[model samples]
Target: MGAKLSGGGGSKFHVEANSEINVTPFVDVMLVLLIIFMVAAPLATVSVEVKLPPAIAKPIANPPKPVYISLQKSGNVYVGNELSSLDTLGDDLKKAIGARNPDEERIFIRCDKGTRYAEFMKVMNKLQDNGFYSVALQGEDDAK
Candidate 1:
């Protein structure tokens, strides 16, 4: 026999074991992160603004591979077809570029693959100390 007798009131909770997961908090967090990044993106970008000098685009039929400055295998300097001393290189570069374009905006440095790092830096100092900003390092590597 089954007998039922009830006489008291108490708190109770009924939970469904098969209920779906709630993702509202996750979605809200992602939206907040997206908005934060949207606000921060523009503020993170910075640039060194300079008053650019006037220039003209001149067409070169051959381009001549630029006026190459080279560091010799014997740790010497060469510009164009002339051998120059380290003491005179900076002045010589200025003179060479002045003869062609006084306001030289670009330069190309071609160093031997076997050249020392010190030698390479010395060559860079020659360019940078004289106010040349645009420079390119050119070399070709063997196919792997």
Candidate 2:
């Protein structure tokens, strides 16, 4: 019976199933992707050149300095470099602007970026109380 079973088929040596993962193919695929990215990286950047026309305009002779009211983040108010309080803001602004009519003269206001909305509103209220209706918020233009 043993002789018959041996002659019937299979190999003499025992073969076990392979449990370990094969990573050589995975490593090869990753390396190929890395090389492809390296070759394509330099082509992604683009540069363009532009030429702008010269600006030509006549200069004004002796323009009067505009009245500037500045509000600090610390809640301090200044009218033309002079420190002022909310209670006296109107008086101080009027003094700084001289004989100009408050209603007609444009008042420029510059508030610190971190200043509170309430504090800014208080300053505006003070200006309104003093009959100064013409108000302008000052800001830097980014399109230079």
Candidate 3:
């Protein structure tokens, strides 16, 4: 068979352009990310060692009982042992605080793990609006 010649008396070869994707660079980037995360995972979590004072070392005479507000997973709000609604929570809290100074009295909020964040915030807002600023969140001890 004789090869076809172009106008300049030289044979020209036509090459088709490759359309396949190159995944080597993508794989290299993924490996780099994996290594970075592996090195950073241990450093991401850090804990502080604390020495707590003995509970029986010092006892105060008639310590005031702290007010407890709990939010359940079912959207139920509790002011101490009494069930309360969101709409009337502010008024109920005001009555609970009574003559005690809001700044001095500590109000602890215990939220269920399954409770919505919005519901927790709503309880906090209600307490803040009612002049209870010394709010604390109560969490279970991790050791247990």
Model 2 misplacement above 4 A: 1-63
The lDDT, on a scale of 0 to 1, for candidate 2 is: 0.86
> What is the C-alpha lDDT profile of model 1 across 24-140, one tens digit per residue?
888999999999999999989877778987788777675433666888767988877788877788788777776555355577788777889998888888777777668877777
Using lDDT as the measure, name the better of candidate 2 and candidate 3.
2
* Per-residue C-alpha lDDT of model 3 across residues 115-140, encoded as one tens digit per residue: 99998988888877877788889999
Whole-model lDDT values for every prediction: 0.74, 0.86, 0.83
Reference-based TM-score of each model: 0.49, 0.55, 0.55
Candidate 1 residue spans exceeding 4 A from truth: 1-65, 99-103, 141-144
Give candidate 3's TM-score: 0.55
Error (Å) of candidate 3 at residue 139 is 0.5
Worst 10 residues of 3 by lDDT: 1-10
Model 2, span 28-57: residue lDDT tens: 999999999999998887666678778787
* 27: Cα error in model 1, Å: 49
Least accurate stretch of 10 residues (summed lDDT) in model 1?
1-10
Indicate whether candidate 1 or candidate 2 has the larger lDDT.
2
